[model samples]
Target: MFVLLITALIKYANVPDDIPARLAAARLPELVPPSSLLYLRVFMLAINLWAIVLKLQMIEDKVIFHSPESQLPRRVEIRLSGFMWCSFFTFQAWALQTFYLAGALASSMSAVYGTPDLGARLPVALWFAFEVSFAVAVLTSFIVKYVLIPRKVQNGASVAGFFGLPDLLMHNCNTLFMALELLFADLPVLLSHFPLAALWGLFYVVFSWGWLARHGVCWYEFLDPSLPKAIVMHSVVLGVLGVFFAIGAALAAGAATISSPYVRIALVLVGVASVARTGLITGIPEPPVGAKKE
Candidate 1:
């Protein structure tokens, strides 16, 4: 199911030759550096593949080495674990980000090289999908690690459920590595780039609205802009989420320099404030009429 969904999304986002030709004809400068995109694509793919291989090895060790007498049961356990892990929101976000980077790299290369018939470029949907996924990956990792885990611990939930070496390596470590890679690979972590994250969210919101305009199908209940209140709420929530993720990504990249206790305290305060602000605003209104089921 994971494979099928990813394959379908890739096919949907695959850029046709006409797109590059159109861009060339328009004579617009390629905004993205092709080399950077290439490096990012390689890095993301290598890390994800390595993580998968590691997980498979761990599964093999568990099933073959430790549980040899229970071979069939171990196999079932491994398969079930694999399925559950793949179905995780974090894993899906990681997969989407990986595929999106691949598409973006291909598209950027096509634009840079004047490849009118390049078959690997990404469409806007795929591009937006990747950007959103990147944000989701960062935010999800941050919340799970810093917020959710602590809350779970305070509530007497088993810490064993929250911390596993395999899960940390696959989800948190990979995300941090990717963030660091982006920082070093000519994509400087900047306060200015943060707005681009919010802009990406707004773009997705508008894109969904455009879909509804043409097809009469609202892609998401919160995105039906026909309701003025829904528009305000969705815009604010997405915009805030985008900015929060952007901040998290930047901090992850700059983790080496964040040695001061004061800075850490400030970051925690800011994060808490942002979450409080979002919750307060979101709770003020009921679901918009457009969001209600018929």
Candidate 2:
């Protein structure tokens, strides 16, 4: 499934002739400083890697509790265990974000140290990944906070007790990092990338079906294969992702027009007010544009 994702994405990706110029957008005002931005991404990349691996190590081979179609308690055991990491939307979003951030860092370095041809070649992987990951990250944060966490709380699990450090980081920090990227990276979010984002969500949806057929469990109840409403739920998921992509694109477009770096940062933070409130994630202070490189 993962192979298919890469092949399809690369096979269909459109890399413009001016790709290097587009990828270099972050360096114009040098607003956040590419080194600073890349370091922040590296920080996110490390956290995501550690948290996801830790999550998988704990859940990988264990029998998972069913939270699917039936009115069963979350503790109700079922045939719901296999590749635990692949079973989650948050994990996948984090994975995608991590992958894209890595690619961005490498691409930036290639542009700095490698020839023009080498730099042009690198954005092929990043172009699609950035757009899809951005929307998915945004969608994950919204759903986890407003939907999944609330649902868990309603299920008699104390919010704090239900999640550990890893869960908290993946669900909350993923979107916050993407929001930071939007603010400082100066990467344009093309509305044309909508189809690529949809394809990404669809791949996961289908992969869930395959996993259901093989292991007989779904990590999410709304994606339960046995439920009649599952189709509607799936549609809603894709629809919401589309909405997020559109919003991100609009925000990126508007941010591009603003010449004042402070005002632009304020504009982006306000646009993603939900993620912006976090003390450490979105709330971490952006370095002043003209400050000495850290």
Candidate 3:
């Protein structure tokens, strides 16, 4: 846990270093100095690190490996996960590109050498759109093959009876983590780009939850005796997510105070609400198909 905390903090902390090029290009007035950015950078790094370690440990145990009549499902899972990560990276890249292009245009009088005009923006936007579209498509495939398809053929296993304590713990935890990350990403985008914030937030949550349902968590786990324990564990995870977002909100609020006190408060409120919604998702587990209490 200690290591994970530091990891998240480090990710948050290195923001300045990671986006220096983008910042310079965007010509975004350095409202916050490099020193201030360093602090936030370290904090975000720590948050990310903590999330990574927890997810890695949880998924490592849950991901199954076997040779089956069809390797399609396994391959699809791998592909979906890979595509999600790639989408994240590409989104970051595109944001950086936008900043650089916008900055160059600000400085340049002529539309020739440095400024990225409509021509450049169009291609970058198209690429980002394609990346997002591809991610959504891949995720849909995973749902159809794994979540919606019959599982008995894999090992004569009952889809409803397959999950145990470990499965419940992993499923709930991963869902919570992913939800929070998505929320965090959306918060800034939402605030900066008001019209699209809600749309993006809805898209992310829907896609992620759909993926979970497709992976076989579509049913409730109410019949499972282990449900109580799973609830507790999930609650604990959500609590941690809440803490992380609260801190992030506070930082963002402080940085943006020059604009309006009310605005800062509103931003913080959004952060809090996002965290609460995340907790809500984990509060109940989806039942496995055909579940009956013993």
Candidate 4:
């Protein structure tokens, strides 16, 4: 995460001043009007920020409850939990991506639509960074909620107790909202771009391996590449999961065309059944060590 932030900062700092003018001159269709895009970015940013705040509050509450005087029988600590970490990373990615997108759109509006702005414009590279990051964020959020969380539940893990309603809405429900937005809200997401999600996952895997090499510790147990077959098996499983998620998103988008209520219901049922079948074959993951039971 720090690496991503520093890279974004360096990229933003090096942006050429006239890049927006050049982009404007390229005659890019205002497929989405600048003002509308700005509004959407702002909305996404706000929601993601709220999610972050809620997450912090959850952490704080847990800490308070586990204080020495609380006399709690066994406090469930989630600070290092995979679900918590995944949520944190997803929120950060979404927030930063939204911020960068908002800035880029604002700059574009100023250059192309003669809208007033506070300062300089962002370069195309920064825009690309933000867009790709946003795509990665959406994919990560979907995989964590659908693949990781459900697997944990099925394996008798007390994953749900670590999160409250707000967290659930932010981490789980927001993925669905993002998918719907991509399908119905005319966002920039496309089927061809789905591979980028897998690329992001590959990058993360490499990054995690590097971190383990340096720190002699693994952030996620499943990602401990040190074991003889761990890296190979983990990489294969993640690749397959990424492809499955991408296909699911594409199918959901395609399903938007079926206007009939009964057909939609049938499609949804089929989708659920397919997910169940996959889960049964793969088996849900057990709670990580240190996960407290209810």
Candidate 5:
């Protein structure tokens, strides 16, 4: 019966000759060869590393901003000092992908046709990186393209000069890399594992608060304690990330038995969902009433 077959595939079989696995899913080996998956991991890792290098170069060079649409005579530079480099949420999400991909790449090199013996972190980290990177990529691009750039233009300034191919690699291309890995590998995500990313967001919230206490400057307007609605902003961002994780988990779970092309089409919908969450089509996100823009 279909029920019996499903149970048989997911059930543990720790026979003397069999490999051990903590995960229950028994994926078909014919779906993808290990070598091909390994190569994809390599590509993802390399792109993240390159993006990190470019981000660091931009920071070190104190990249200045300008655009043909700008009316300002003076150039505005992206100014971050000391530990401020890690304060950006986009940077943290991008770096986390690099970290996860490097580890995933090493493990995938020897992927074989047997129950995979994986560490505690890889599965959860994969889900966390996948969800966060997708959400950040969606939100950052929209904020930059619609909100930040146009606001700067209205102010007789522009920030587009600072965005480059490196920007493309870091903020926009994350979902592509993640989707490729998802196609070739099993992205295990359970409902319980959703907290890991919320915890990650919490960790950054505390770290950013510490930076504000020590440096007396908050780079992000939403998280500034001087603002009355800062806590509300923090809660909203964390809530959005949780929504992303839940959606990603559902998509991954649904894709477990589907063909690769179907999975690809379904994954594309996640980005579209994120765009809808941003409310870009309806209106530009404005500050809550009476909260002066920092």
Candidate 6:
């Protein structure tokens, strides 16, 4: 069943190509080659979404809501939950990653095979925006389930706080915005889609804000909060990375494209290191409070 769904979902879809890349070329083409690598890029996106949905379903049934916990079954469930949470984090990280990937792939293809048509590019562009928004929605959902939900559990806050009314409304608004953007993409002017995309982004920001408030975080705690330190810690770490990337860019100058390979390699290494670190931390044992020494 999973294989069937994946194959069905990932089948290559028709794409338009007359993007910015073609405008820079000496001559513009009316249509792009269907076999062109750019046209097939959406298949890769479909595969990613299919995989995530499958893994999420599997994790929920096999680990998160397991009926029993004891002996090997208990140990396996614990390990699987940890693994599922890691998957959640990766899904979250893919937000910016997918945006860049999709943009770069499409632009690069446009450079190679020429642009398809204004009509074609509009649908694809709107699709790209919709994909990014979906990525945000999935990431936010994962963060809520694993981080915010767990923190609320630990902090004795009302479960209702975790699913506040405001966040729900913003979440629904973002969803509707994405739906409208895609609905009108090919049928209307390309520029018309931008408003919906912008609205989605705005609602997303508001949703994140409401998330923080619902979590009981104060503005002062933005830097370093004792409660749910992961939020602050991840922010600081990403900030440091942004700084490092900026410095690298400055040092590389115009010819810094030569260093692109090394940067890509370094990113892979960091991802591996993070996965290992998560595994190690999850493996640690937690002692019960007020338990007498054995």
Q: Which numbered prediction scores highest in lDDT against the true structure?
A: 2
The alpha-carbon deviation from the true structure for residue 106 of candidate 2, after best TM-score superposition, in angstroms, is: 1.0
User: Please, what is the whole-model Cα lDDT of each candidate in the order they appear?
Assistant: 0.47, 0.67, 0.31, 0.47, 0.54, 0.35
Lowest summed lDDT over 10 consecutive residues: which window, candidate 6?
Answer: 66-75
State how far residue 212 of model 5 sits from its true place (Å): 2.3
After TM-score superposition, what is the CA distance of residue 212 in candidate 1 from its true location, in Å?
Answer: 30
Off by over 4 Å in 5: 1-32, 59-84, 112-157, 257-263, 266-294
What value of lDDT does candidate 3 attain over all alpha carbons?
A: 0.31
Task: Estimate the TM-score for candidate 6.
Answer: 0.33
- What is candidate 2's lDDT per residue for 1-294, written digit by digit as tens? 443465456655665766555554563346566556656666877887887777766542334455544543334344223346557777787887887777766655654556333344456556667777889887877776677655654554334422567776777677777777777675778898798788888888888778667656666777775676778988998899999999889878877577777886776666566642233453323334554321
User: How many clashes (backbone N, Cα, C below 3 Å) per candidate?
Assistant: 0, 0, 30, 0, 0, 3
**lDDT for position 33 in model 1:** 42
Better of 3 and 4 by lDDT: 4
The C-alpha local distance difference test score for the whole of candidate 2 amounts to: 0.67
Locate the minimum summed-lDDT window of 10 residues in model 4.
61-70
Q: Report how far residue 212 has shifted in candidate 6, in Å.
A: 5.4
RMSD of each: 15.5, 9.2, 15.7, 9.7, 10.3, 14.9
Global Cα lDDT for candidate 6: 0.35
Cand. 2 TM to true fold: 0.79
Q: Please tell me which model should have the higher TM-score, number 1 or number 3.
A: 1
Candidate 1 per-residue lDDT over residues 165-226, each given as its tens digit = 55555546445544433333222233433444565456556665564454444423345555
Give the winner by lDDT: 2 or 5: 2
Model 4's TM-score against the true structure: 0.52
lDDT (Cα, 0-100) at 60 in candidate 6: 32
Ranking by TM-score: 2, 5, 4, 1, 6, 3
TM-score (C-alpha, index-matched) for candidate 5: 0.66
TM-score of each: 0.43, 0.79, 0.28, 0.52, 0.66, 0.33
